[model samples]
Target: MIRVLLFADLQEKAGIREIEISAEKLTINGIREHIMELYPQLTAIKTAMPAVNEEYAEGEQVVKAGDIVAFIPPVSGG
Candidate 1:
């Protein structure tokens, strides 16, 4: 089980801030796919950036069970 923190549209669309997926080692790409599966409106999640343990991560980043993953969309504020 992995802990995922949703943000912005993701939270609004899914009505949940965190989710636990059933996987031993879930990759960044795999997370996107799972998110899209859970929230069909978030298909664009594949283009967003994800972080593992508060560090910038890539599409192929490996997320093991018990790891904390944060989903961060592009930031823009003045």
Candidate 2:
């Protein structure tokens, strides 16, 4: 299973900070889509940045089983 982490408003919207996906493999973009299906309330996820193993990942980055993925929502501050 792939572990998914949610942060900021994403976590609040989903009502959870972490999730485990049973898929053996999925692309970053696929992960985003899957999460959206699971939690339609998290609409901001479409623009969230994905990270794999603590490093930023591209949309096409492949995530394997046991990998840790985090979706960080956009933040604005001044």
Candidate 3:
């Protein structure tokens, strides 16, 4: 399973901080698409930054089973 974490607005919008996807492997973009499918309310996910195992990952980065993927939305404060 691939563990997915959502933060800030994404988390609030999805009403959950984590999600588990049963898949052997998927690209970061694939993960985003899956999350959107699971939680259509999280439309912002399309622009969220993806991190794998705590490091920023590209859209094509492969994520295997047991990998941790986190989607962080842009933040702004003044």
Candidate 4:
């Protein structure tokens, strides 16, 4: 299973901070799509950045079982 970590507003919108998906290795885009399907309320999630094993991941980055994937939403400060 692939472990997913949600941060900031993404976590609030989804009402959860973590999730696990049972599937073969999935690309960053694929994981984004899966999240959207599971939590449509997180509309802003599409713009979130995906990370694998604590490093930023690219669109084609592959996330495999036991990997820690995180979705970091945009944040701003004054």
The list of candidate 3 runs beyond 4 A from truth reads: none
Question: Candidates' TM-scores?
Answer: 0.89, 0.97, 0.96, 0.94
Cα lDDT of model 2 by residue, 1-78, tens digit: 999999999999999999999999999999999999999999998899989999999999999999999999999999
> What lDDT is reached at residue 47 by model 4?
85
TM-score: the better of candidates 3 and 4 = 3
Model 3 Cα lDDT, one tens digit per residue, 1-76: 9999999999999999999999999999999999889899999998899999999999999999999999999888
lDDT of 4 at 28: 86
Candidates sorted by lDDT, best first: 2, 3, 4, 1
Clashes of each: 0, 0, 0, 0
lDDT of 1 by residue, 1-78 (tens): 999998897777788999999899978998888888888987547766789999989989899999999887776789
Against the unseen true structure, what C-alpha lDDT does each candidate score?
A: 0.86, 0.96, 0.95, 0.90
Candidate 4 minimal-lDDT segment of 10 residues: 42-51
lDDT of candidate 2 vs native? 0.96
- The TM-score of candidate 2 is 0.97
Error of 2 at 13 (Å): 0.4
Which RMSD does model 1 reach against the true structure? Answer: 1.3
What root-mean-square deviation over C-alphas does model 4 reach?
0.8
